[model samples]
Target: MLVSTLLERLQSDPGRPRLTWYGDDGERIELSGAVLANWVAKTTNLLVEEYDVQPGSMVGVNLPVHWRTVTWALASWRVGATVVLLDGAPEDPAAGNLDVVVTDSPDSWTGSSADLVVVSLPMLARRYDGDLPPGAVDAAAAVMTYADQIIYAPEPDPGRPALTGSGVAGAAGNAVVGHDELVPEAGPEEGVRTLVDGRGRAADVLRQLLRVWAAAGSVVLTGPATAAALEADTARRDRLVATEKIERIA
Candidate 1:
């Protein structure tokens, strides 16, 4: 229900910029609300149709703080699946009790005795070309084949578990935040453009990005930054806000 509400709000303003991501290799990607919703829909369909991931399924996301990570989280929540954020490969994969594990590193999960879905993390959302790890599903390839719109028989329950961290300290869902209070940050007047330090924890970065979108703001994220790049970014945009553990400049 919370995922549906967020998608509906995003659909209301399809043309607005919701995410703008920059990779360490200098690749840049900008996605509108509609585009993001489409990705989420396809991902949800992939989970439901391919993996049979139904409500209450535990979906592990072993990925960095990237745009696709956000899409995967939203898709899992859309189908009422509990999202488990993993910083890296699980020490004992079976010990996590995950129904499905999605990761950019297929090799890491190949030996894990659990079902694995591999994400290429391509800049253009392209599928991997060569041979994949044994018994691993190509998420980008599978997701593209799904419908862009999702139609559930019975809508997902809002009170169900939505998100959990690798540890027990990071469990939360619509029940914790409530439907009306999705994000607590102040809404940006025009739009927010912030520089996020991707080196931080993936869950923290994800929560911050969601907060920015809830405030109707766009993000300009990067993995670590050089002084020159930071200066250039600050000079180019008057509303740019830089977020780093050392110092946050607005």
Candidate 2:
């Protein structure tokens, strides 16, 4: 029920900015609560109707710390799927098996025999422009065809495994909140604009963003921002609270 709870919170403030993403190419994206929830709903439908992702299924997310990744995580949790964070498409024989793998890499699953989903990571959430690898589904193209509202037959269990790390342990939906709350003061005030560094592991960044959302705060994520760039952007810095550390800017 973690996904539902978060969605309810977001719907309560539909117009507020929940996620602000800055791509490495300087493209900016802002998703309000309502917009984000709609995307989550569409994604859930895609997983259920297209990929047949159900409860107890393992979904490997081999993407970066992008807004689409957040959408995928929330959608997977909504259907009671356990998300596995992969740096890229599983290539090694020792990478272990997965029910499904989602990645933005162009060459992912090029010659492999795996169920892979490819995302374009477009600025407008558009489909990929070029040719896609064989046996890989285009996520952006497929997801848009799903309904905005999710209509699942069975409800998801909160006690089921929600997320699994690369080498670390897995956590159930009921325990995800506790895990995010482990960092003291990591949660920001309501409507506060918090800056988060996206250079760390995708899982870590996603966890931090979840904490911010739990506190009803908006996030300003940057990719490898320099201290000089941070200082130069006074407008962005002034909106941020002093509690934000310098390391976060870097």
Q: Top model by lDDT, which number?
A: 2
lDDT values of the candidates?
0.68, 0.70
> Which residues of candidate 1, in runs, are more than 4 Å off?
92-95, 167-191, 225-250
**How do the residues 1-250 of candidate 1 rate in per-residue lDDT, one tens digit apiece?**
2657657877788997677776766777878889988989898888888778877788888887787888998888777777777766768432277888888877767666667888878766568766687778888778888898885522456666666665323334321232223234455443555556676666667667767666666666665443246566765333334322212222
Q: How does candidate 1 score on lDDT?
A: 0.68
Give the Å shift of residue 44 in candidate 1: 0.8
Per-candidate alpha-carbon RMSD to the true structure: 4.9, 4.8
Cα deviation of 186, candidate 2, in Å: 10
1-250: candidate 2 lDDT, tens digit per residue: 1666767787798998777776767677888999998989999888888778977777888787777888998888777777777755466432356677788875866655557788878766578777887767888788888898886624566656666655323344332322223222433355566678777777677777777776767777766553236567987665543533222332
Single out the weakest 10-residue window by summed lDDT for candidate 1. Answer: 241-250
